[model samples]
Target: MSLSLRPARRDDAALILAFVRELADYEKLRHEVEAELADIERDLFGSNPRVFCDIAEWDGAPAGFALWFYNYSTFRGRHGIFLEDIFVRPAFRSRGIATALMRALAQRCVTEKLGRFEWNVLDWNAPAIRFYRSVGAIPLDAWTTQRVDGEALERLAAG
Candidate 1:
């Protein structure tokens, strides 16, 4: 499959949202998705954009996307790319699209001297875990991911 990757445009919000819902469903967390296409458009293309994305097209059709953001690591004393999401529809899986997207993200790290690229995978997602292993990513077994979400996030921010 011929794949092309480029920065996503505002017009692609609907497509991006569709893919995001697909991912949420696949992960069995569809109910947690309260976001909309307008949210994506604003965060990705607004004056103070919080993130950037690159869409992947396979055979002239939207196949997947890589949404990422810059993160500062105080210990590392540098910036890194935090991969918020990378999803390729199942119909287009096993076509190296995901790998290609990761390669592009890594290349950006190297080109920009970003310290590292990081992301979290669901513990039950063996397939994704295997893929990350194949890509030479080592799991941080000693570290557990922690998060404050929803109302807790709001409460914390208000304090």
Candidate 2:
């Protein structure tokens, strides 16, 4: 299928947003997607970008993307790549596109001497979990993820 991966460009913001919506819909979290094209552009293509995205193309067409950012691990005393999202269109699944994306990220970790490469998957996503496990990803089962967003996040910032 001639798949290739490349760093996303500023012109790809709309496509990336479309992929985000598709992924949210698949995960049944469409209602929670508050991201807009402007946000994507500013965050990913600004003068000092905090996030980055890699696009996967199959036969010169958009197939998927992986969005990530650097995160610090105080215990490890180094930076790691925190994968914010990885999504492949349904028609492109099971074609090693996702694996290729992950492999590229792992390569980055190795080259950059990063302490870890990690991401979270929903508990109910058995297929995704299986794919991750097959790729030698270990689950941090003991760690429960917690987040404060929306009004709570604003309140915390105000304090």
Top candidate, metric lDDT: 2
Candidate 1 weakest lDDT stretch, 10 residues: 41-50
Tens digits of lDDT, candidate 2, 67-88: 9999999999999999999999
Best by TM-score: 2
Cα TM-score per model: 0.94, 0.96
lDDT of each: 0.92, 0.96
Model 2 CA deviation exceeding 4 Å by range: none
Candidate 1 per-residue lDDT, tens place, 19-88, comes to 8898999999999889887899899888989799999999889999989999999988999999988899
Which runs of model 1 end up more than 4 angstroms from their true locations?
A: 154-159
For model 2 the TM-score comes to 0.96
